[model samples]
Target: MPTGVLYVMSTVVPGLVKIGKTTTGRFDDRMRILERNGYNNVTGLHREFAIEVERYDEKERMLDDIFSKARVPGSELFALDINLAIELLASFEGRQIYPKTSTESKSKVFDDAAKNHQENTDIQCIPEGTYYLDRKRPPLHVEMVVEDGALTIRAGQRVAEHDSDRADDRARELRRATVAADGTVRANVHFSAPSQAAAFIFHLSSSAPNLMALQKVVA
Candidate 1:
């Protein structure tokens, strides 16, 4: 009796991992099937590793339990780093596929995410007009275009001004991200609370960016 081997997958959509079982040796085919099927949102998919095991369903259940906390609200995807995700999968049976990054890099990743969450600030600038943002950390701040009911933000060619951890560690989930975009992150919101939209796109505190009076050139 040939038992199916369970495979773990990773995608470029940050903080999302996939766990599934494949009976075929060419697991890429299965990935393709998934890409064309339900994973339409996943642009780039990477094969982490396929471990042969007994009772694939049991293995799937076990992985689910281990990552139950990181699992997305309504999907098979788990909100976790691909490397850390692989490590967790390997740890199941004492398997040793460690994370890609070294210990220092891993620590920095978490640390940065934590710093970003803790340093959230309230919006201080007055709203109601267009302006450019300037932050110290994520050097490249994008353009801001204000309109009647919605706000449009261009993407930053460089990283955010203030880089920090995004793991939501220590219950630090601050703002609501309306849209996750490449060149820009948009939020259909009211100007009265424009900071909400700004905080989300730049991944900073609402008050950090001069939402109202920063670079008046945008006015």
Candidate 2:
């Protein structure tokens, strides 16, 4: 019958996160303690997402069980993709406690930019060439080619599609991701911008990191 808050924190290490729970009143205090003292000797800890929920203890345990394989023994740390963690946390029925207004609005701006890119196909934000889109956690390396004002997935490894009930459709898209003679997976799907391309490849939202921002130009 315990009600509290569940939170996910990002660590200095990429793709690593800490999932924990605390009473509603102690939420801010807990964050300060973790950020100030650090956890397991790991510093640069920052809150990524949090939610106030009923029976938060049970919710936290459920998440731990779900990600047990990725968890560090005897520790709250898990070697999992931050975005995946965020999605799961957000799905829980509760009021979002972190990423207050300013951050949320920023995310909205990024989404709007993606939408505008889709609607205005003629506006090319990146130059035509080959580039690499690399993500650390749930590690991915995708070779992309931008030509004729279109972005195509030339090759990738460990590509994850958006999770949904449309298994058949997802399978069809995966089928398009063919394996090359060199053993790399290749896809012919075209997108307008890096964000859109990443969203499609990872089944992530518009908030996915834009390759342009990363400056990962290879060609």
- Across residues 1-219, which tens digit of lDDT does each residue of candidate 1 receive? 445656667777865778777765656688677755546476566665555555667657655664566777666777654544333334233212212344333333333423343343212212334645455543556555555544545443322333336423211242224333343334433322334444554555443323221342321
lDDT of 2 by residue, 109-138 (tens): 344545544554431434455665566666
* TM-score of candidate 1 relative to the true fold: 0.38
- What ranges in model 2 sit over 4 Å off? 102-219
What C-alpha lDDT do the candidate models reach, one value each? Answer: 0.47, 0.64
Q: Model 1 misses residue 148 by how many Å?
A: 45
Question: Candidate 2 at 80: error in angstroms?
Answer: 0.9
TM-score of each: 0.38, 0.50
